[model samples]
Target: MIQLVIVTVLLLVLFFGIGFILNMLMKTTWFPIYGYFAVVIVFVVYWGNAGSLTDNLTEYSYADYIPAIGGLIGAILSGSAIKALRTRGFKMF
Candidate 1:
């Protein structure tokens, strides 16, 4: 369906855009993959429990917002994880 296509594209952009920004900020490449994966995991969680939350966001149209939320969560998680890894002497090469 067109909706699914749009959702996928938006999710990819959201994930990649956040990842690219973090990669640039930290000067590393792996962070992007981390961010992307984080987003995917979050999306999976949301997908698993859509009815519970989707009903609350009645103002919004379409379920694609789930991935957008995932992207935001992923961005935050990615930043924290990257920082934590660096603090623990994990070097990205």
Candidate 2:
């Protein structure tokens, strides 16, 4: 309930901050989105708890997914923000 909401918001802020810094340093748009996916894949593989893809997908509860979705949204937003800033002549971004 409340914990889930807090966790989701925390993940969102965490991802956004990380992605924002990465974009600033790398000067690449959309890299954070790809990085996020790569990180998820690596974590899944490294944990070795993965079954078939469908099984893996079905096993997680909403509690597991909601924060992840939030984080993904954050990462995407960071990229968009960076792109918009750059477009608007924010050279540092």
Q: What TM-score does candidate 2 get on C-alpha atoms?
A: 0.90
- Model 1, span 1-93: residue lDDT tens: 677666656765676567656765777746766656565556644566447655535535456566565556555555666667777887664
**Clash pairs for candidate 1:** none
Each model's Cα RMSD: 9.0, 1.7
TM-score of each: 0.42, 0.90
| Residue 8 in model 2: lDDT | 93
User: What are the clash counts of all predictions, listed in order?
Assistant: 0, 0
Candidate 2 error regions (>4 Å): 45-50
User: For residue 4, what is the lDDT in candidate 1?
Assistant: 65
Q: After superposition, which runs of candidate 1 have C-alpha atoms over 4 Å from their true positions? A: 39-93
Across residues 26-63, which tens digit of lDDT does each residue of candidate 2 receive? 99989989988988767754454666766677767899
Report the error of model 1 at residue 3, Å: 0.3
